[model samples]
Target: MTANPRGPNAVDRHVGSRIRLRRQLLNLSQEKLGEELGVTFQQVQKYERGTNRVGAGRLWNLARVLDVPVSFFYDGVNEGAGQPGFSEGDQTPIVDDFIQSADGVALAQAFARIKDSKVRRRILELVRTLAAEEAEATATEAAS
Candidate 1:
């Protein structure tokens, strides 16, 4: 089993993305995370980009520091990917995408700070309504 020299493996990328997501969710900067890991910011960037593969011990350390289990990084990995009969699917990780974006993060932070449960439910309903309307508008535009 040989890895491609062009880029990181799928599993490595997934693990790195999970690390990045957790770090972002905690509002920790790359430098802060690097400091905790005793590594430079650039090294942390590399790790998050999957340019460097994380070793088992380092991954465990990351899990400890991030307050997640080591298995968090491997949460969505296909059981038999890179095998003869199994192929990796092209599904976008929507939660990771949302977590990685500034607007999404800001929205989440603001929503979390709204301490009232009724207000939170109302906000959720509003967002759902807006999304449904937007989707309908897009479909109508496409049909025109």
Candidate 2:
């Protein structure tokens, strides 16, 4: 796992990366997602960068617009890497490979206004935990 402090902050970046990946998977454009969400592309960029915190309401709207589950954004986050982040075995190519595309960043920006700390932190823990577990499972499969 990465040596960097693993907490809410890292979780934000991971969320951003996942949003970007999903966007790519659906072949949607930043402008398009923004248009559907009734926001500018710049705002979406902020959301995907973790610069913006998505709120419960906005996340719902985004999920609806993107035709995905709200939980989708929280997917791939690992719970084991608490505040300290990834440990030795937890670190892997897949974790580092997650990247936030430009559009994904913009998408993230739209939800940047979520000011509730508790909600953000809770979401972070849940996503990170799931992500880490998935990564570990994948690694084990490959090794076997």
Candidate 3:
């Protein structure tokens, strides 16, 4: 967004995009999300636009309201986002990649199901391990 002076501004945009995306994915209006988070729709709008920082306390409330893990916001913004001199190569993020995949949508739906708490936890663990193994296999095959 026009070179954000290199600070939390960058992270803000990422988190903001995530908040907006997740909110939209759940079909939640800003007013609804604001009510859940004890804020105003204007506040939600500002947060989603990255015009204001999301504090940890508010973030926790957001996680509960959004029914997401707090790490969800930081998932895509890793070392890749910490480029010393940002370039077009670093423009795309893990979150962006995740959102582009049909698997991501399927995963979200699966998460929405699993009424059993233990089953949900097990499914997450299993899927993570399987995805890791599959990715490793693909990388190895590529190298070969």
Global lDDT for candidate 2?
0.69
The estimated TM-scores of all candidates read: 0.75, 0.53, 0.56
Error of 2 at 58 (Å): 1.2
Ranked by lDDT, the better of candidates 2 and 3 is 3
Worst 10 residues of 1 by lDDT: 81-90
Error in Å for residue 52 of model 2: 1.1
- Give the lowest summed-lDDT range of ten residues in model 2: 92-101
lDDT of 3 by residue, 23-111 (tens): 87887889999988889999998998788889999999888888999999876674655354654255685757666345775577768
Task: Estimate the lDDT of model 3.
Answer: 0.79
**Residue 81 C-alpha lDDT in model 2:** 38
User: How do the candidates rank by TM-score, highest first?
Assistant: 1, 3, 2
Residue 78 alpha-carbon offset, candidate 2, angstroms: 1.0
Once fitted onto the true fold, the runs of candidate 2 whose alpha carbons sit more than 4 angstroms away are 1-8, 80-144
Off by over 4 Å in 1: 1-7, 82-88
Q: Report lDDT per candidate.
A: 0.84, 0.69, 0.79
**Between the candidate structures 1 and 2, which one is better when assessed by lDDT?**
1
lDDT of 2 by residue, 30-127 (tens): 89888988888888888777776666888888878778898888776677533453543545344336334445444455335667889777767997
C-alpha displacement of 34 in model 2, angstroms?
Answer: 0.7
Q: How many angstroms is residue 75 displaced in model 2 relative to the true structure, after the best TM-score fit?
A: 1.3
Point out the higher-scoring one by TM-score: 2 or 3.
3
